[model samples]
Target: MDPNEVPDDDAATSGGALPRRAPGPPRPAPIAEIDALSGDPSFMTSLARGLAVIRAFSERRKSMTIAQISQKTGIPRAAVRRCLFTLAQLGYVHDDNRSFSLLPKVMSLGHAYLSSTPLPVMAQPFLDHVREALHEACSLAILDGDDILYIARSATTTRIMSVDLKIGSRLPAYCTSMGRVLLAAMPQAELDAYLLREELKPLTDRTITSRASLLQALAAVRQNGWAIVDQELELGLRSLAVPIHDTSGTVMGAMNVSVQAARVPVKELETRFLPVLLEASRELSMQLL
Candidate 1:
């Protein structure tokens, strides 16, 4: 059962209850997270390299030698060896002399997230319902620069967009449904910087192309608690999004359902789609600590 689902008595085990929490940090971010970024290029470069090495091994390339890693990640063999050794020492990887792969221990990283993190757990059932109710692809996305990075997704058999909609895929946040929700949650200074940095290239004819216009849209997202974009990211695409907040009322993420404009109209989206999105967001917030 969820922590919120149980009362004080139900939290007890055979011997004792869960330890009481002292006042911790403002936000209970996952452990092993990097501190906030600095503008230093060298530091960012190293961090990127380390992440690249980890990204080198996926479902297809589960085990790789130093040469294979060098070929995949475009790092020198010596550098790949060094990183592998470091990861092995950190208990995040394992090797059997010839090849290397991640250990179950490494899962603790995302586990540290999925276990203690409140939103994902709550979102699972809600996503299922949203997909069933909407008859389209539904997903959750977190802010990642000028892009909305999909963290979790559920899709109907009839795909909405041509792009392969994988969980980790990223697209221009300004054009997608999820991005507007995150942008609406940001402080004005950060929003201004983002607008200046993000090139206002029109992804399609329907995309917002000016900073003034984008900010006005974001303001509407804040006031209305959701956003809808039609053919903004790709041709013939339509999507509606709602903001999901955590216990602290920060924008935890955005959830959206994407459909083909030929099949679903804007009126149907606002009337039939928006209610389900709102209910799911509300259900997700109740589970947050």
Candidate 2:
């Protein structure tokens, strides 16, 4: 299954009543201007709007009418139509006369990043080793805005979460083990800004909804060098994560092992899985050095 594809059933769960895929960060409205390039004639609002139109189609909304695209992106309908036409001409989108959908060529945009960056490529072998040793799904993710974006993964056959978490999957930073570890690595002012800007919504009964509780959790992750999130993102999913550092001791990303809560209790995760995860993280860190 493609990790980027959203499951047909949004409410699907492995062994719990609530949905496994927690809500991601709310999509921002369309940009009115390129703030940094305010007076630059080279800065093109049309190009920015075109990119926005491409982003309008996601896993949930795979295809959309021009009107739908306009509504989602806050771009004018005519502008959306023009963007779609241009994208179709460029072979980036497929237009069936009624609605438009992205084509495989769109993957090239992400490919450019993956090809240029060594982090995902170097982390893959380490993730595979962790998955083999722990017999669980392992992934590498970096904090993107208020969410954690999966950049590499080694998945197990057994599904731990309802959502198909591929290389580009995004999950809330406040409710995931990887997110906690990445957030803990942030400088004090940046973390405060994130807390102030993001609205924390409870996904399950176990989710930490309060800023105070979340701050406390981040404090623990910072001090302990790792984090364990038990059924916070999904009721039946538990995850343990450690920060991956570079040569300069800068936190580059997070590596995590996720398992079903029923099969692996918190105790086993801490005692059995945590050490292995830490070792894998250390190995990856050394490679960076």
Candidate 3:
């Protein structure tokens, strides 16, 4: 077995097991600093509540009633109702008697960022090229908070992961190959703050929950200029990533190719995929110049 590949029968990882799932959709992660932000003069609580209400809807919970929205966001029913009313008035949401759903107009919100930003526009062609050549799923992402946010993707017809990842999807930075490349490029102090702030919850038996082990993995990424995650983010999913740099030679983002672990061995990631991924990373980085 590859040193990085953990067996399926392996026991719970070092840190701990994840919390048992509740029935229905999972509870939303809590909004960070919502209470502290209330004291800031520039912070708009109403706007925050409205955005929270909007975010509560997802692929799993597409159409929800006012009470459901309140339950999902932890916002009060009255506030949720008002926010939904305002959103419906603005045509961003639709109400059909019992439940409310997002409208196509909501795409405008994401389109504004996609249209204004050059990274996603520039990365798309490179991603397409990788997908066409390798016949595998490829993606580009930038570190956002403690997560890696997918900015662009070229997906294969065959799905490899349980989660449907697309632009705007987020995954924890600790276990993903792209996330590791981005994290390895961080300054010492910034990386330290990130390690201190984020919880390294074990997503699978292979996940590195021990701080020392994770630190060692990140050190290797920094030294090697690439990263490989073996079923750490999810069982049967493996990925390889390399850093994309700007003209200044500073790491700006990451590019990665993902494959099903059962179909591809771990060594192929370094042998077959690394060279192409590195070349693409270099070309995309130069384009940013």
Which number leads on TM-score? 2
Candidate 2 TM-score versus the reference? 0.84
Give all candidates' CA lDDT scores: 0.75, 0.84, 0.83
TM-score of each: 0.67, 0.84, 0.83
In candidate 3 the C-alpha lDDT for residue 109 amounts to 86
Error (Å) of candidate 2 at residue 212 is 2.0
Candidate 1 global lDDT: 0.75
Ranking by lDDT: 2, 3, 1
**Model 3, runs deviating above 4 Å:** 1-30
Candidate scoring better on TM-score of 1 and 3 = 3
Report the lDDT tens digits of candidate 2 across residue range 1-289: 4343222221222223322334665444463232233235455656777888987787788999998987787666766787889999999999999999999999999899999989999999999999999888899999976789999999989887888788988899999999999999999999998898777888999999999999999999989999999999999999999999999999999999999889998999889998899999999999988
lDDT over C-alpha atoms for residue 212 of model 3: 83
Top candidate (lDDT): 2
Task: Give the per-residue lDDT of model 1 (tens digit) for 104-205.
Answer: 777676667667756666687889889988777789888976678777788777766777686666778888889998999999899888886677789899
Worst 10-residue stretch by lDDT in candidate 3? 4-13
- Put down candidate 3 lDDT per residue, 87-181, tens digits, no spaces: 99999999997999999999898889789989999999999999988899999999987889898999988989888888888888999999999
- Candidate 1, residue 20: Cα displacement in angstroms equals 54
